[model samples]
Target: LVNGVLVAYGGMVPFIATLAMLASARGLALQITDGKTQIVTVPSVLDLGLPDAYVLGIPPLVLVFAAVTVAGWLLLNRTTFGRRTIAVGGNPEAARLAGIDVRRQRLFLYLLSGLCCGIAAFLLIVLAGSGQNTNGNLYELDAIAAAIIGGTLLSGGRGTIVGSVLGVLVFTTITNIFALNNLQSDVQQIAKGAIIVAAVLLQRRTVRDGT
Candidate 1:
């Protein structure tokens, strides 16, 4: 909510606000534990993360991810709010001119983002069995790379849940391959950056040709 207000009414850039929150949140976490990881011992939570725990041969976490993805797809592809979101993203001024409440849309979108983040945080805790401030380093880069690679326009205006999912799978595969090859983290970072750049260039070219 604070983040939404900051971006919607205070004219702050979304990325800047998110970055600040990420940094501050991590810092506060580190301070609380002096950089130690807190282990979670609850069996129920651990079951969600472990591979041994499965339902219908599918892991709980995977099911949660799939359900969320489907819900997102339905919301974006079949709902009025999704259209408004796209319009707001593509051009806030134009959306407002069209009688859409652009600021409110932005605020709601931010709230939606926060809700997703909370879900992700829970998943992370279950997966790791421990909470550490050091985790999720360079996650923003990974997220941006995945989205752009999945065909989500950097200029905003258009995005698809399926594309984002495939992008995540591709990125995860690349990460695993890097690990298998014993590549340095720096190398993986470089690869993600290159992917983003290439994706952006391709998007621009596609836009140009379309025009």
Candidate 2:
């Protein structure tokens, strides 16, 4: 987890710094060109300009994120491919008996997880208007915490995407409320940690009761 976070933050730092430099240059040029000057701004994505690629009426960020989420859901629930995933995650021995390749299922799951991470990183860049090394710091923890809170059994195989969504919303709501109250960042972090532990404990109890 630490390594993944470090790599993500490392990439983000340079990306955001470059974006800032590009924006600064654009602003400077616009200022110098004055109102009458027409500086045909050719979009260079490498420079962070809104390029023609963006003009192809690209799907909105929210839509893109939703699409990815739905794709993940369908991949886990609708396809024979998805059934194999559940089987492997639920019981490796049974999956093998059923002639499912456990290794292949796990590999696919990891690939899917990677794809989701990439989508999330892109969305973070778009939404922040700039990326920072600290951007998404500890986000993995947040995601896991949300999944657990949403009732994904730690033992695996019993979680729903809908439950994960609700968990994320619940976590967001708590943070939003704390921000509105002007709490310190440290306090919010502590609260989040406590909430995650409490949520997991409750979930464990529920699982134990076989509900």
Candidate 3:
């Protein structure tokens, strides 16, 4: 429905449209919860007993993350859909010329993204035993930062799941270090902004040199 409205209206790009939707969603959540956090009780199977369960002395969440990383890598590198995605990202006009249905592909991708978000939300709620309007505030920024740091082209075309995983680790490490040092949130934001700028500049340089 959001996509239909955005496409029909034909002004905002997907990112901007999504941002507006996010704001509305957050507002609705706040209204539903009366600005209070919602506590959730999950079945044991869904929880995976992260507080007690460990395999090879590794936390369940770490194992789950590793599994997801491997699955993402396989999907992106070993599937025809993945190849088409890369082609579309590299040059949508060329992809269309080559018989790829760019719109359909994008719609499928969006559905996949929603599925991932649903899964993430489930896991998050299970982990925290709660849900709130503020649950994923600023997560989009974190994801963009990670993708940039992971060598994903801002202009779109190239990326690696492995690189993204490493990028996430780097961000996580930095956040942990900051917390340990008792640094201010402002400093953390500054650091992240600097990293994003550097990544973008590096990508531009690479593109220029390639040309």
Candidate 4:
């Protein structure tokens, strides 16, 4: 609601609106928590995040993620709404001319984003057994990088849920590998930036080749 109102009604670009949101929300959260981490003592919530809680060796969080992925995939690939979303992303003016309500669609997308954030927060609470205002700091970069690497065109016309999932998996693998090798944080960031650039360049070439 906040996102939709700000971006759709307030006439602010999504990036600027969301960045403002981040700052305001972060400030509010810090004021509420005094910039401290709040520990979770609930055994049930904490247990869900444990290694032994896996079914068939698949973590519960992975299951939740898979369910959400399937739902998103269906919504995006198997529905008229999804087509409209893609059309709007590819060309908003064209979509509006074609009778799609562009502002409404954008607002709906913002709402969907909020829902995803809620789900992510729940997962983080389970996995960490604590909550902190700083929990997701800088994660947006990884998300964007993953989407781009997953074959999501930077220009925003096309994307796939499965591809983005794979992209995030690749990004996570890189991070884990770097961490295991005891690399510095700066080095990891450099590697990630390089990967993003390479992915963009390859995508551009593909687009140019008309393949």
Instruction: Write one digit per residue (lDDT tens) for candidate 4, span 70-171.
Output: 999999999999999999999999999999998889899999988998898899899888999898887888988999989999888889999999999989
lDDT of each: 0.88, 0.68, 0.80, 0.91
Clashing pairs in 3: none
- Cα miss at 34, model 4 (Å)? 0.7
lDDT of 2 by residue, 102-137 (tens): 665665665566678777866666544544444455
State the displacement of the C-alpha of residue 99, model 2, in Å, after optimal TM-score superposition. 1.4
Candidate 3 accuracy as lDDT: 0.80
lDDT of 2 at 115: 70
Clashing pairs in 2: none
* Tens digit per residue, CA lDDT, model 1, 1-211: 8789989989999889877988888888889979888999888898786667888889888898999999999999899999998999899899999999988888898898889878888998997899888777788788888898898998889889999999999998988999999999888888878888999999999988995
Cα-lDDT of candidate 1:
0.88
Name the regions of candidate 3 deviating beyond 4 angstroms.
1-12, 43-49
TM-score for model 2?
Answer: 0.71
Which candidate, 2 or 4, would have the higher lDDT against the true structure? Answer: 4
TM-score of each: 0.94, 0.71, 0.89, 0.94
Superposed model 2: Cα runs more than 4 Å off: 1-59
lDDT of 2: 0.68
Our model 2 lands, by Cα RMSD against the true structure, at 10.8
